[model samples]
Target: MMFRKKFVLFFGFVLFVTVAGAQDRYFTKTGKINFTSKAPMEDIEGKNKTVTAVLDTKSGALQFSVQMKSFEFEKALMQQHFNENYVESDKYPDAVFKGVIANNAAVNYAKEGTYTVNVKGKLTLHNVTKDVDVPGTIKVNGGKIEASSAFNVLLSDFRISIPSAVKEKVSNSIRITVETKLDPLKG
Candidate 1:
């Protein structure tokens, strides 16, 4: 009888841990972010594929971190000016967003479907942080979750300024797109 009780208790504990570990958290390291600026004279774009992100499906919490200098531009001069004059990557090497999903309960993680969610968070870039609420989609397919969103950010909001010499070549408003496939974090 004692051995039976111990076996049941141990099995229950293992089951509890397995359920807890499989449901709550998701993470990704090779996320991708793209930013584009369209102006009268130029269309500039930068892509970065080294983003790190985490999501807690149970608590609606989401976070992202990326290196500022990781963005790659098509032209060398534009990339140089972007890091040196605009974002100042040396001083602010990282950009982070920490926020929560406003209506996280609407998404049924157990089901395979797409859910639209509103993410409310603070975006920090170039040493400045601002409140941001964006619409994002979470697609759950084959037990995999794909998160994607696109939003526009003003350069001046992050203390990023374009020099007068190249002001016409760059737009003050930049559109950023984020994409990532998160994997279940298992212990």
Candidate 2:
């Protein structure tokens, strides 16, 4: 009887750990990120739908990565200039953000509601990394979490140089928007 009792306790502990680990992480592959450049000559915009993001609900840790080349611009020439001249996608293939939700404790992930949170992290672009704190919303509904945020990025901060000839066509700052629907990570 004692041996059977020990075996049952061990099995119970294993089950608890498995369930806890399963509920800690969430991920998404089809995240979308869009950016808009408002200049005097024209408004330039691009969208990338192949972003990958991961969130740890337990720790409020979040990270995302997007390929610079994956961004699609309406004008092919604009896209070419962006990749070759501005961002240099060939040299810097990906842009990434790794950060945590600053107000994680205020968010109750077990309940369904929308929570406004400030995310503090480092954004790497054009081979430059900068610390950023941006306000964003996290919505928990039916076991899924949706996160969205919009922020502006300065080109000079990332060391992206705009040519004197076309500087008027592109703005010094760009508006960026990110959205993702994350499901629980599967074992």
**Candidate achieving the largest TM-score:** 2
In order, the Cα lDDT scores of the candidates are: 0.94, 0.95
Please give the distance, in angstroms, between residue 75's alpha carbon in candidate 2 and its true position after superposition.
Answer: 0.9
Runs in model 2 deviating more than 4 A are: none
What are the per-model numbers of colliding residue pairs?
A: 0, 0
* The 10-residue segment with the lowest total lDDT in model 2: 19-28
Tens-place lDDT digits, model 2, residues 30-118? 99999999999999999999899999988899999999999999899989998999999999999999999999999999999999999
TM-score against native, each model: 0.94, 0.97
Local error of candidate 2 at residue 178 (angstroms): 0.4
Top lDDT model? 2
Off by over 4 Å in 1: 3-7
What global local distance difference test value does model 1 have?
0.94
Model 1 sits at a Cα RMSD from the real structure of 1.5
**Candidate 1: tens digits of C-alpha lDDT, residues 15-123:** 9988897768998999999999999998999999999999999998999999989999989998998899999999999999999999999999889999999999999
> What does the lDDT come to for candidate 2?
0.95
